[model samples]
Target: MSEGDRDHSTGSGRLVTGAAWAALLLGLWLWGTEVTDVRHGLSVPATGDMAAVGRPAAAELPPAAAPLKDARPRRIDIPSLRVQAPVMPRGLDDRGGIDPPPYARSGVVGWYAAGARPGAAGAALFVGHVDTEDRPAVFHGLGAMRTGETVRVFRDDGTVAEFTVDDVQVVGRDRFDARQAYGVRQSGRAELRLITCGGTFDRASGTYTANVIVSAYLTGTGP
Candidate 1:
């Protein structure tokens, strides 16, 4: 689909995009398992051996309600492809920010705050649909992204976190894995996962059968 002809039905109403189904599966897999020894290259600190490095003791807390103090994201820009969209925080009660109404003709990117923050200790997620029933969706070109591309996320604090594309994969709707897409950790550096609809459109299901996931990692911190 062309950029302007993109679809946005996935995030609205009863529409369930392939990405959403993957997220649900990931959650179900994490219900009774404990993640251990997450590591990246040399840059990320080792959380499993905090005491070996002489760090003070830290208390454990419930995973679902873990507290975070990073700055909220305010804007998202992809310069190489000329994409600029205002960022909206999204969470329970729509606490983050209201995304543009589905099928909106304007250029507005949406954030999924129910996920994690980029460069933080969790999986940061941003999602947009591939198309609307009548027009092009905001993330139509997401599948064309290549490795080594940069995606800059501007935050409310005036700092921008830059991430380098590491990998991109397409998952079947019924088999998408959320933990691999949203919960994996590489050191302590912030990670990002961008999602959009792909694969053949099923008119009967009213959604696509697969999701395209673009994974990246923080490369630098700057203004």
Candidate 2:
């Protein structure tokens, strides 16, 4: 080949290689930035739908030998997870939908009143923010929970309901399946669904791409 043609070919190869390296570097930077944002809880979604296994049928719980309305959850404790917080009656806000509070100091442990009660026949729904304004909040360490861990719910009626973790899974926020998270259920047993934000974060939108849900079932109860 002529000297001029050889020189041109070599220059083009270098240009292509440099462009490829630049693209790779850009992708790594974006990925790292996303991870940082998620760790800080800056871009995670503020709300998510609970997924369940099956739809619960409408049936009255067996009459307690004693009335136990006073036994509703008042505080939640997970010793292995180092979580201890008072339960609040977190119902629908003015928007008429279930959403976790934006602030950590809200001190609200939300409950899906539309779902079943603890120790009832259906899955009881609970949602909380992992963090807010970069401050750790309730359920912050929820992602670290493993199967067999115990979650204690202290009912107002002085009864403590204990639940054993069954599984934890992460699903995309846009693909969150509420029925699979909060509706499906088995017979004669109460279930629990806990949700928080996780997965990749998007700095442009300031939210995570997915949510982490932890499922559990009633193991027993005590005073």
Candidate 3:
């Protein structure tokens, strides 16, 4: 190739490369900042349709036996993963999904206050952030929880709701089944679900592509 021709080709290549980098950086900025709709993007849909009746029951049916007295959960300690974080009462966001703890308090977990309370005969929901912008958050290692592992929740009533991990499942955002992930599996059983974002991060959406749902049931109650 002639020297002039080679120089021209190299300059053109550099221009294309630089343009690609600029586009990539601009895309990330938009993805991260404009991802405000993620409140609804968490998982659960507007119908709250995690039910077999084609609509969510007002709530899960309580067990045949009376439910344990409601005790507000204060903290959750997952010893197997060494995850201990404060529990905060959280309600639905504008999108009708469980609002998460503030990103500034990423190390904490949010309890769905309107849902079943811990140790009660229904599903108690807890949600946390897996990571902050650059650091691991409260439920970062929750995927490591194994069957039969212990989860302890301390309450204000001086009793601890001890749960036995039943299973861990990761559901992709595209295929999230609210019934399987959040609905009560065994009628009347005191159940728990620890949820956090999982799967790959979508640069365009600025959200995780899946969710890690850890299911458990109350096996024993203690002080």
Per-candidate Cα RMSD to the true structure, in Å, reads: 12.2, 18.3, 15.2
Candidate number with greatest TM-score? 3
Q: Tell me each candidate's TM-score.
A: 0.67, 0.64, 0.70
Candidate 1 segments whose C-alpha is farther than 4 A from its true place? 1-69, 92-101
lDDT (tens digit, per residue) of candidate 1 on 66-174: 2234777887777755777776664422322223224444345656665566555556777666666555566666766655678888887778887776665666666
Clashing pairs in 3: none
Q: What TM-score quantifies how close candidate 3 is to the native fold?
A: 0.70
lDDT of 3 by residue, 126-219 (tens): 8887765567778877776656778888988998988887666666656665555665656666777887776655444345656777777788
Compared with the true structure, all predictions reach lDDT values of 0.55, 0.52, 0.62
lDDT (tens digit, per residue) of candidate 2 on 1-223: 2344335545221111111111111111221111211121111222222322232322322222211232366778888667887765555444344545435343456665545566555566676666554455677677666567788888766788778776566666555544444443444456677766666544444455666767777877788
The CA lDDT at 156 in model 3 is 86
Residue 51 lDDT, candidate 1, scale 0-100: 24
Residue 214 C-alpha lDDT in model 3: 77
Q: Which of the two candidates, 1 or 2, achieves a greater TM-score against the reference?
A: 1
**What order do candidates take by lDDT, descending?**
3, 1, 2
